[model samples]
Target: MRSALLHVSVPFVLCVTLANTSLFDEVKVDLAYDHYAERRVDYLPSFLAMPCNCLVNLAYIYMGLYWLLNCRGVKETEQGRYMREVFAFMAVLYAPVQWVRLASLRRAPAVLDQWFTLPIFAWVPVWISSIQRRPARWRAPGAAVVQLLSLLSYGLSLAHERGFEVALGCHVAAAVYKGACVQRDLGDGRTRVYLLLAVLSCAGFVVLKLLDHWLSRYWLFQRLTGHFWSKVCDVLQFHFSFCFLTTLTQRAQGKTASQEE
Candidate 1:
């Protein structure tokens, strides 16, 4: 996996560098300041944004590779193999979604950005839950229902207030419910540490988002790294979710093995 990822990174990094070079050149021209004191278009330090973008994309690519490796170990059942493939495919989706979001922001409404991301957040738990086989009786349908309601609530809330509260509220509830079910099935072990970290990561993701939103309202934040910080938190949150879900899935498998013995 490491070797494969390293080979993949070479092309990925080269592409990003070339893309950003063109993008920044265009942004400079389009966002140029007027001599007569007209307002400046919103922009960030290219140095900062470039590196952050690279890191975010790298994290996503790594997760995709991780799942590709995981797929090899999941041959016990057809369902397991399919789930692992789905995980890998979702990981691959992250980078393209980000690219589309960047393209949208260049000429489209900011709301279009959410179109690329919101569904991913909603469906992620459902996918992970299905793989973990928690809530054994209704795992698939239950997970689907939770994600659907979360998305629907988010859509309505976004229409009414144009903020993340209602939808994020539903997401948190779903995460908690899913986490609780996982916890109930686990016997005491170090996997508990992974669960704890997952919870902490979720909390951190929320706090960082709230802070970024609040601080971005002030000009000082633009100069001092509010946006960059938000990017970092976004990368961390996605990586942490992968860690938690994979660890929990392994623990579930362990329990199944012990029971069969």
Candidate 2:
């Protein structure tokens, strides 16, 4: 996991850094407190200015840590652990990108906040692919290819005002389509529940964030804010994605073992 993180960090940093420059000038990013309906605390640090939304990021860390230690069978562990840890690491790494955006309110962190999201969502299909194929040999190389493409997909944002939205939409669609495909092929009742929850959570994540301002008009959302709930939904989706994928992997492994026996 450490080696994988290190390998990706180099190009990841470079890509986001490049995006922070004029290359991503046309990309739509929220840089002001006004963009969020949450009230900012004047006495607080920049990172904690909007306490509710900023602190909600901790959920991502907690979820990540929980899953990071959740290793299972020896056979499944070898291939499955890689996918799990990488996804968990992504959840852990994502919190700070969002917090930094709230704190520094800079173009770079904002760019990072957007750029990091693509691969995180794209990993859904990557994990699904591993389960659909020869897991032992194919997972690593296949993940590398998918993740690289996910990173490059951000280049779409350079073209139009809604380029990021278009790219994100594609990632979301691919994840959903791939997830349904896998669920149809291998999922049981429990896996079906997890997949449904994951899809609902993903939808909530997108919808709540989009309605940040509109929902703020209501008393229920004024304090917690739609953006805050959106992060909550985001964390839930990650958790369920883990549940769905690992369950599928374990089921496949069990089938393979029974066949060999």
lDDT of 2 at 7: 52
Off by over 4 Å in 2: 72-75, 136-139
Per-model TM values vs. the true structure: 0.61, 0.94
Candidate 2 overall Cα lDDT vs. reference?
Answer: 0.86
Task: Please name the candidate that would achieve the greatest TM-score relative to the true structure.
Answer: 2
Root-mean-square deviation of each candidate, in angstroms? 9.2, 1.7
- Expressed as tens digits, the lDDT of each residue in 113-212 for candidate 2 is 9999999999889888878884555647668888899999888878877888999999999999999999999998999999999999999999999999
> Which structure among the candidates has the greatest lDDT?
2
Model 1 TM-score, all chains together: 0.61
What does the lDDT read for residue 33 in candidate 1? 23
lDDT of 1: 0.50
RMSD of 1: 9.2
